[model samples]
Target: MARSIKNPKKAKRKNKGSKKGDGSSSSNSVPSLPVKVWQPGVDKIEEGEELQCDPSAYNSLHAFHIGWPCLSFDVVRDSLGLIRTDFPHTVYCVAGTQAEKASWNSIGIFKISNISGKRRDLVPPKATDNESDMDSDSSDSDEDGEVQNGGSAAPVFQLRKVLHEGCVNRIRAMPQNPHISASWADTGHVQVWDFSSHLNALAESETEVSRGASTVSNQTPLVKFSGHKDEGYAIDWSPLVSGRLVSGDCKNSIHLWEPTSGTTWIIDTNPFLGHAASVEDLQWSPTEVDVFASCSVDGNIAVWDIRLGKAPAASIKAHNADVNVLSWNGLASCMLASGSDDGTFSIRDLRLLKDGDSVVAHFEYHKHPITSIEWSPHEASTLAVSSSDNQLTVWDLSLERDEEEEAEFKAKTREQVNAPSDLPPQLLFVHQGQKDLKELHWHSQIPGMLMSTAADGFNILMPSNIETALPSNDA
Candidate 1:
């Protein structure tokens, strides 16, 4: 296990303390104000007026930079069990970078630890009007305030890099063996690598180490395939099977990979042909071993059963514009989520697929293209979405608009948060710190923990209000 440490020198921290009021509008307790809401496209800002983040909306938030911008990344599952509610959490991740030059790109393996803080759960007493006097009279402040008040400790990061030939468009780690990973490069090649050495080095290192230009001699991929005529962004490793993989390309070609040996895979030449335009994304069904899903730029979603041959078993015209991403709900296997280039996302029930009426819910909240989407592994009705508009949103399908509750909430919070009535009631949280938000993933081991990558940097956060069931300690 990776050890936790104090604030790292290379890391820049932006941590805020907790405020008063519980996250409720009950009659007895002073009604807690709702988090201030800001929509990227819907809300307009006046000259010299900038948007500020509501610290009360976050339980624990931390940001770090990896020197280069990354378009896609995967959270590497660690030895930690599925239900982890402990503070000061540690996580491992693998990301491929889009460097300024092709030769500058590399595969980064990260060990981010000591992510401590829980602001949302704390309930301090309401500060009186004499708060200013209290601040002036306080002798112990600064670093002493954190230690005396029991604030969350800052996080630390350690990284290792592996040189790559071209810019990585997308990357994924095998669910069965996280050390074995795959990357799709701009050069129209898919390569697989083993990061066991890097993982071991990070695990054993006692201090933080950030290697930007470090390289090992003869560092080569375990296997490489150049069968795709065009570069692609769609790739997924099947969770049901150990080494079963599916990849699709811009030429509307899809291929399957089967593990031949421990570190080798064989991809068949005959590709699955079901779309007229570019294949945008691919996802393997959570429940079915032989079933998978694919979305295309032609605005169609196809369900493929490998046993049924190259043709898709069923297909549907999912969107008016290009469908960019797909995320299958692992808890509720019947639900499938798709994000489109038109900034709308819809959820469909696989069981109700008949005559093109399978859509159960649709939302057009995002004004820019939807860049990434994923269903939370911990909650059946929860999912997260990222868009080019530089916002990441969390939604709960289980929530519905309650007129009386909404009225009561608005009455109490009207003075604090002036949100538009048109905003969806199901929308739970909106995180807006990064620029050109590209992708986001929920940590399977830690409930409510989310990591997102964008043009600015990476954000690892846990919303204070999102409810997640943590297993009992005795269990």
Candidate 2:
């Protein structure tokens, strides 16, 4: 059930830390005491404030959840950090670092709170006896002996935190820990924070931690690569290998770093540059760690073999406009999708043979710049896309048929005359008829369900079965 609460005075008080001129102060007299100042931005806004605004208005004003209103400026740089959401109050992670100089400085978890909403009070109803009985069959052994499976485990919802005080261009979650790695567009060097220890300390101290403290004193950074004259736009941790990470910058260069040794490898060492313009996004193949793909502002997509260290192994002139995002299907290693500023999205099959390595599936639907694309982890062929046109679309890549095969199938279709629909019916889920979709993510635990956030500050969790082909209004 969804509910909204209104409290204007409380909303204002919640935002007091964000008010201009609020600053953090420390005293030598109390070295252990930490002073926290609420920096004004969107992430700090109470959920009640977000729920009160018109969804459409929220979308237009806060597109990308970027800039002053969205408060998404803070970047999380270390292994442990905290993000607050509307429900369950707070969420945190423990992060691992690759820095070698500070091997003893492990990442610490941190927490921040001032969340307000009825959703925070929501708890799943107590389980019935039959449900408990069913859960007993799936018991797992733990330190506390057998544990029931069907009972509610810890809540899993998390909101992204503004890790730094500047604009965040790239964010990557560490594979080993709950920690996240981020690079700021404004700051030149990378920083890491331990969110787990911070959260634990915050729980004990019952206070929020300061952002710019000497928190990473004991952390480890594998390597710190320098030489990019422009802002770094993307950073990705190799899922297949620990301590190996890659980053791309606005100058159209890709840098590979070994976090522990601080060794740097400039992959683009030749004139056959991967992209003509800045590399907007890059993702390592979930299946093949040695392989990865990069999309650029030049409207091109290049697939690279990390070992070659020079030119891309395969290249495709993907979109008419700059490609902003790339997402790999978790279930299929060779399947991927790209979103572009031209308001179109293309799906590619890495396994398909091309004249010179081309995209397999090309989809153009959004009329405005497509900002984000996400592939469902649970469903192999399902994909979710969001754009600046204030729209979110769920695409089924399995429905795509090759042109030649489609033609042959059409000839047979004429003979049959009454063929069943080849396109599986789709469930177009909408939230209050508003569509300024900025980001959408499928539940890691739940199949056929996902959540979406809009620039308008409206976040919704909707199940795919919400709109089935039923005669009645409710499915």
Candidate 3:
């Protein structure tokens, strides 16, 4: 496990001899508020502002690859960097190849060096569609980084091109395996591929443009699952289990697959179906191996336990409109976050589900439909949300949340089920300056770092005070 970042306890030290809310002073109970201290070594309680990133300057890919093209894509940072020492912190980006379809689609692998300071772009791979079309098969004009023919010897940036048949909807990498990933495509196909050799080769060479091809290398899906009847976008690998996988489609159905033998994966033909409308998204519980949750166009969120049966373990109507996306809180048990087309995002406590008071906090701050939501791995109460409004909001649910606010929320829930108090989760940072934002993900290794993609380009946002933002133990 990574070292837990601890906020300085200078505040607690200052108020060491304090009285408790119980009206007792003998025990030296902590006061309502801790003292404030500004020291040379310790970071103070400072609010962070969003910083826009320049892709070209930080060695990231341009919005367009071959030429200007509109492509539906997915972006995921490889969590393998945390467990594997040799693998650098990298991102796997898959974009639809409408223009470059005949040749190959680009699955760009970017290597990021440092993530502490002003966020810089990773080194996106160098890519050209065709192999034979290469001017020099194994040679380069400039060895010491020179410009030629109105382009740098290798252009500003190039991506390692991985070829697939159709458009890739999502890519879920294995939590334990650094070199394996499962990808679902618009062509109704699911593929599991070992990316070790290819990624190593891509990392070694500075000028190899076309390394990933169908004919060469182990480009085939080690195990392949057929596509859904309609659109198949949702897929996830269980973090608690090695090969337990779940996939959802647009037809209100979901399937679970488990590896049966060596190199053989047994996929259930019959889905664990329950949703009224299309299953929009799915998230495996961070703590439970057999338990998973799904959000649908029907505006309901349902939790299922495969060990118990196909029926839902718990269910709740999460939104008035379609629940577009959701995330299972990794750091805290029993917490789930979801976003809807009604331009509202909510966080719910599963323990309160049976009591009909599941919604703990909600915000209608976005005027457009939310596209993505992700809980921060480093902090339990922190999360990031992106919407069609082309903006991203990073929320710290623990910020300034006193007993009064929580008590009011409980009181409000008594009047109406799922009705939370007026106090919304505090906004730690808001990111604008992008159009039609698609996806946002936290850096697996760093506490306060995140990456987002949009119509214009990708932006890497890092708050200045992420190191000491969340206190180690809440009072």
In lDDT terms, which candidate is top? 1
lDDT of 2: 0.46
Candidates 1 and 2 compared by TM-score, better number? 1
Error of 1 at 250 (Å): 0.5
Put down candidate 3 lDDT per residue, 182-241, tens digits, no spaces: 776667777776666665754555542422232322266687787467656678888887
Which number leads on TM-score? 1
| lDDT rank order | 1, 3, 2
| Model 2: worst 10 consecutive residues (lDDT sum) | 10-19
Q: How accurate is candidate 1 locally (lDDT)?
A: 0.77
Give the TM-score of each candidate: 0.86, 0.56, 0.67
> Each prediction's Cα lDDT score?
0.77, 0.46, 0.57
TM value for model 2: 0.56
Give the per-residue lDDT of model 2 (tens digit) for 201-297.
5455644333224344433433333456566555666777765666777778776655553233333323225888888777888888788788988
Error of 3 at 9 (Å): 50
Better of 2 and 3 by TM-score: 3
Q: Show the lowest summed lDDT stretch of 10 residues, model 1.
A: 1-10
